[model samples]
Target chain A: MNYLHKELYNLLISDHHIFDFIRESALDGLWYWDVENPENEWMDGKFWTTLGYDPEQMPHKSSAWQDIIHQDDLKVALENFKKHCEDPNHPYDQIVRYKHKNGHTIWVRCRGMAIRDHNGKAIRLLGAHNEVSALKKHEEILKRCNSAASIGYWEIDFISEKVLWSTLTKEILEVERDFTPTINETLAFFSEGKSKTSLLNAYQNAISKGESYELELPISISKEKTKWVKIVGIPQITANKCTQIYGTVQDIDLRKTNELKLREEREKLRISEESFRANFEHAAIGMAILNEKGQWLKVNNKLCEIVGYSQEELRQLTFQDITFPADLDADLVLFQELMDGKRDHYQMEKRYFHKDGHIIYIILAVSIVRNNEGKILYVVSQIIDISELKEAKNKIHSLLKTSQEQNNRLKNFAHIVSHNLRSHSSNIGFMIDLLTNENEKLTEKEEYKLLKTASNNLAQTIQHLNEVAMIQTTLEENLQAISLSNSIKSAIENVAAIADAAQVKIINEIKPDEVILGLPAYIDSIVLNLLTNGIKYRSENVDSYIKISSFHSMQYKVILFEDNGKGIDLEQYGSQLFGMYKTFHRHPEARGIGLFITKSQIEALGGRIEVESEVNKGSKFKIYLKNEKDKKPMYHR
Target chain B: MKKTKSLCIIDDDPIYTFGLKKIIEFGKFDVETIFYENGKEAYENLSQVISDGESLPDLILLDINMPIWNGWKFLDEFTKLLSEPSVVVYIISSSIDPKDREKATEYQIINSFIVKPVSIDKIREILQSN
Candidate 1:
């Protein structure tokens, strides 16, 4: 025994005062009991006082303390005391709960020793008491915190080849409280792929190099469940060798899954943004982004090419700067609508000024982007160059104007030629007639006959020219409303003698009130010519009849003259039917000038004529004239 | 029958006037024929005759295509001067254009329109009608 213990034993045996002094100095609570009597016992005042009790009011029996002790703890204490009395090998130290005077439990650690007689039989029991309620409360708080935080503690001792796991750590690994795991078995809890390999490498490095690591890895909890865990391994080094490694294993499965999902969303957003950038940079049509003030924010390569500017140069300029001055007002008006929230997009054919100072035609489409509050953010514009198309259109317009002017000049020249020619031919014929009349012997001469024939032909040719010139000259003459029936009746009367000689019946089917817009002279001439033609070309096989009718189309008045005559074959004579001097028949009067003059007169009234003819059946001549009654202003002069 | 006692011919073409005078002679019409080169000359000489208190020509043949004054202008001025002309008038021209014929009818002084190269029978018809 140590001197202190021997002195304590000597004080306990020789003097109770010295033992009391020792107890007061070093112990919180002291006790003494008589094992042989089993009832008598002593407890210091401080022991009752620590439990919120007064020693004077307490019982001096062992059962008094027993009744106040926890029932389960009393049973354990009794068993341990019995074992200590029998073999004196088992310890009699235990943490027990005691009821306090305030009705709350107090925690205490009790330690006792048996005082034996010479025969080694138990005589008395002496014990010390330490109140540990604050310590117990702190331990309870730590365990609750670990469980709440899903943090478990673990340690590995390399020298002893031992592994220790806290109660919460065992729970994290999903093992029973009594189950023990070796180093390799503990490592098996990590998932079989990256987690296992990384952990194994980390552990090896820690044991050999005394390095530390903190890693988040996945752990298999069950056949179908995997959990993410954060492990921190800290190696304890002694003399430059690793002797232990210990750290926390935390369950981070929820946090890690949410983090992974957020990263995937970010990656997807990045890819979409990249693709949009690619499309903008390489678009087929010119594209640009502009601010609300019309300043260019970004321009694609195609836009640069169309505007004949570098992207850097364009970005410094506003859209209004490059826009053609005449086209700016229209573009701004539409832009104002977008700003006012009246429209979101607009499209127009607009002009822009190229860098080289030429006008460029473009089809521009603009769309405005707005914020949640409806404020304009920016505008996107798509431009298609149409300069080539505009140039071609302008070229065609000028060509059409030139051709129309030339055609008018040609008509004027033809009229002048016919007028001058007619005068000369008339003089020649008159001289020929005078010669034939004055000198009857000269007409009987063969050469005189030829001269007469030639003179007659010259007059006929001049007459045809005069007829054609009349149409050209009368084109601009004022037209009057003429009664179709009256005009046709007069024409029939004029050709009545010829029709009667040809034995041709004439039928007028026109309504008596039918009226048309034309020069009265032209109407008379056109009707007379058709009447003469019908009589002259009467089919010998049939009773020739000439029918005249009038009808109205959408914008024209149609006059039809149907004749049962030896109709000219249209297929053989269609193109030359209206050509001047193109005689198609051997009739002595088939001068071919009548139909030609008729077609020309119809055209002078802004009309057209069509002929439907069969070789021997009949011919139908339809003349289409403008129906100017309802709409006279367009055809007036 | 009223004889065409005095006749006047206005034309720019000498050949046309000659042929017309020959036809009148061949018709054996007892008429004195006078000739002017154009409408301006005819108007001046006829105005002098009116001013001198001499009788106007019994008939006047006017040509449309002329220099200085066309036939239509002479008729317009002369008709305004004399509201009703005692002399018969005919508009004779080589122009076969219907517009020209239509225009001649607008004048009260005009008696008729005759196409050029007047044949012997046409002249006899005109003299006998007068």
Candidate 2:
């Protein structure tokens, strides 16, 4: 009993100041109990004072602790205390909650130690309770932060080459909760490709060089499972050497996949824009892009060259500034229609004034580009240079007019000669008749005979002139379809006496079914003239003959007259052979009028006559005439 | 045969006039002859005769193409001064153009159209028909 009292009395009186100092220093509340004397329980003054109460207002007895203890913690408190009192080796150390004077539950770490006698039975219990609610709250917040961020901490020991992963880190690696990993095994979780290589390098740099690194990479944790993680590693150096590497491994798979998708989309957009720019620049035709205000937004090199302006110079001007005044209104109407969305595209031939103030004809095809919501964005214009084509068209028009004027002059010549010839022939005939009546007064009748011969020659000249006039004015008469074979037969019969006198053989091979559209009289005149001319030029050495045949070609019916005649030298006199007053042969009867009239008649009837002759060889006169059965009449005259 | 008081011929060709004069004299038609080288000379002389109220020619021959103020233009001025009821005008030209013939026929006072180089027989027939 004295030993027990000495422990208490000495602790309270001799070292009572030390006991008070320990109670004040170590805990917010303190208590002691004498188990043999249950009535001798004492609660420290701080026990009540820590709860914002004066010791006088609260009982100093240990029985008062039951009321102050939380109701929920009372049963636990009594059981733990009794167990500690019954056993000397057992310690009472636990966390419990207590009710504050303000009716709030306070979390405290409570520790109790028991003192026992020689019998090895606990006699007194002494305990300390310290409030730890704020610390525990901070620990809870840290756990929440880890879960939200998907962050897990890991550490690698250099000595043992072993790895320690937090509970969240194990979850990230898709491993079991009880699993322990080696440094090599943890590195195996990274993919075997580029990510693995990079991860290995980063791990080596962190451990060997005291370097810190952060990387996001793809990692394969299990079979058929891949994830992306952001790793941040920092080195811990000891004694100027790296001894540990530790970092966080965050699951960033969703964010990284989305970032990759965004980058790929941006790359595609860049490629398409490059392609559009390239096509516009290298196009063979001029191309331009203009904004809604007709301002040049983009112009290709071809357009700049056509307008004779540099890109910088052209950027300051609108489309209207370069357009020729005459074509502006028409082009504007189309442009306005496009702006109003009434028309999507328009094409027109418009002119532009080059920088040098010269005209350039262009065919413009323009279209409006619109946004997805149908708002006008820009105008895409294409230009084709047609200045050369326009020049060619103008040249052709002038040539046609000149040719028409020549035709009119020929008609005029025909008209004037018709009247002049008739007048001359009539005068000669009248003079001849008057001279014949005065024959009695003349001494030489031969003089009168010479005058008569002059009149007869004048009549012959008039007849030839009439024949030319008929060819020229054939268009004024009705053109009728005639049978070529019948015409040839008639011409042959008409010249039968002459052919027979010359002993000429006529071989006619023209088909009876073949037909042509021509004036009847002109056809007879043409055939008769050819036959007579052939007879007139018949070869003296060989048996004279004329072979006539007709056949159809693609666009014309060709009539061939092959003759065994004394063919003239066409190389020397070829051009003049069909010319009026151009006689080739020395025969007195050879009048050049025949071929000239024949050519004119053939041309007027929409046919062409070509003579192929070699000095001694036969002459083949090829006449290409229209085959009326296949198509409409080409030439009325 | 009908007798004519006066016959007038307007032509630029002297040969045609000489032949017509010989034919008329040979055929013995009773008519007076008057001559003009072109429409201008004939129009002036005839306009004086009409203004003086003198007797007009019974027949007039007009040529189409002349040196000055040809037949068509002369007709425009002469038609306004038309007062003689017995005078008949005939267009004498060598043109075979149908358009000329149609245009000459439009004048109501024109008797007929005749091609030049007049013969004796045609002169007698013209005198008899008139």
Candidate 3:
């Protein structure tokens, strides 16, 4: 019977190997202590091993474990263990450090329970020790991640409805470390309106349904300061009921600021586009957008008005199509450079074909539009129609030409005046010199002849200058309608004796009804000069024949005077035939003034005179006079 | 100083030429006078005399305004005929233009530019100075 009882006890002990197997696999140590006697303790070999000790060398006593306990944790571990021994029902749990065999400390977690007799006297304590060094290192890693990410954890007790904040959470909120806030007080820290409401709803939903949620919300930790945070809420469930709410809170203020700045930049771009549109549409100068082919992409009202083309029509045609042919190649070359990105802008004075097919000069300034990468987008052309300015310029050129011609005439007149005046004055000086100088022994008749010649030259020069001045100042109102036949007859009658002496026969073929608009005295002078010239310059070896005739032609009364005399060399004197003091013939009676006065008088009456002659042939003078009806047709008729 | 042996007047104006000739003759300046109508005729006659190895006129009165080959052009051609620069030249002209006087001064062969009408006293002074 004694042998059987010892065997039963061994069976009971070996059956407990399952617990030993679990402790060994979990890397835990097992221990037992006698509460009835303060010195009785039992430590598994694994416990000594965890403390870096050999159990075979150590005695089994409470002092053996007490000797390895860390000094700072010994008191707290002993007090908690004493409480567990005294109550016999209290849960025993503690985290403490044990000294290693190498003199360094190792972290450990101890859990234990009290064993009592039927009378409730505590007999022993059973516990397990976990070498929590790796777990502690893992916890430190999690804490560092949270701090680096600016993330903090939060918890809410469902039963107490109170919120608990971690150290990082308190730091993020800029709150005191010891401050414990209720759920309502924590919600009050959120922004007053939509943020607070959304956060409360999410929190309540998480607590009720054991759901997890994430929200980005703006929270105001103080009266005036606000920050953006990402809130992640997870509910803790036990028996399928939510007991606690816990989540992470991340400060996202920097990201939120960047987003807001991006939105403001977008709004500024929109405003810039609006301003560009307004300027393009309402600019005073003509503006247009053209494609690479020079076709108008868009045109403003000013452009349409300038080209006299409708917007639709302008868009349908390229600029080259409407440009004047002369200006096409030059404008095209500049446009090609713009397309190649060689030039940013080009300006030129160009001509375009208007709607009416006339060339209109314009000053065009064109700029190339480019994308960010320097690709040509389109061309913006500004056209300034300078047609009127061009016209005025042309007018000025014509005026300059006329002014140059008039200046040349004035120079010629000055030369002629100088020559005539000098000849007469020099003659007078010669006469005086001859009369006073005792060295020159002049005869009386010779002296008288020289004096007479000087006087005649002086008088002729004065008379010719007076005639020029008279013609210049005479008004158009001084002209009148004079009978052509009567003027010719009177002139012929004045030179009758000279005509008879020269054996010149005058034939009057002038129509009695023919009349011309002229100054009467000027008409008399012109006819008298011509007739006398015909008789005075008569051929010395031949009979002189003078035939005069007048006829009515279109818009003029034409008078023809034909004289059979030595004709002039028209080619040699054609340009200066009527020039003042220009004499082609060397006749003694040729003062070189008759034709000059005749030409001036005819011009003053708005008529013209032309001569037809050859070197040896007779000469014909065709005088064109304004017909009476042609002068003021409506009034005269 | 010796009086000039012979003097020549080349002018188109007959009255001025005749007056000048009489003044030179009556001055008893001991000079035979020669006359020509224009510069062309005068240059031809003078060139012929020089080519024949005859002595040129001691003094020449050249007129500026003439029908053909006036005084300035004549002087340009006349200098080529004679190597000696001793013959005195006097320019007589009715032109009061300053440019003419300036032009006359540019010719080194010309002695003086005189404004016509040429007086006997001015001629007398020129002869005496020469």
Tell me the spans in candidate 3 whose CA falls farther than 4 Å from its real position.
Answer: A1-110, A113-125, A128-159, A166-180, A183-226, A230-250, A386-421, A428-637, B1-5, B14-31, B119-130
Candidates' TM-scores? 0.53, 0.58, 0.55
lDDT tens digits by residue: candidate 3, A528-620: 988988887677777678899877678888889898788888889988889898887887768888899899988888888999987656789
Model 2 RMSD in angstroms: 10.6
Using lDDT, give the best candidate's number: 1
Model 2 chain A worst lDDT window (10 residues): A470-479
lDDT for A147 (candidate 3): 96
C-alpha lDDT of all candidate models, in order: 0.86, 0.82, 0.82
Better of 1 and 2 by TM-score: 2
B1-130: candidate 1 lDDT, tens digit per residue: 6554888888888889889888988878788899988778888888888889888888888999888988988887777657467888998888766678889878777889988878999888887788
* Model 1 docking tier (incorrect/acceptable/medium/high): acceptable
In the order shown, the candidates' DockQ scores are 0.43, 0.23, 0.21
- For the predicted complex of model 3, DockQ is 0.21
TM-score of 3: 0.55
| lDDT score, candidate 2, position A163 | 88
- If both were scored by DockQ, which would come out higher, candidate 2 or candidate 3? 2
Candidates by TM-score, descending order? 2, 3, 1
**Poorest stretch of ten by lDDT in candidate 1 chain A:** A468-477
Tens digits of per-residue lDDT, candidate 1, A1-637, equal 7999898787799998886787787777988999999899988898889888889998888877776799998888889999999988899999899999888889999999999999999999998998889999998898899999988999998888899998988888778999888977887787778888998899889888888999998899888988888999999999998889999988888999999999999999999989978999999999999998899999999989998999999989999999999899999999989888899999999999999998899999999998898888889999999989999999999998997897787666555545567788878888888987888888779987888788788878766665665465344347777788899998888888888888999998999998887888888998998888888889898889999998888788999999878888888999999988888889987888888888888888888899999988889999998775754454533
If both were scored by lDDT, which would come out higher, candidate 1 or candidate 3? 1
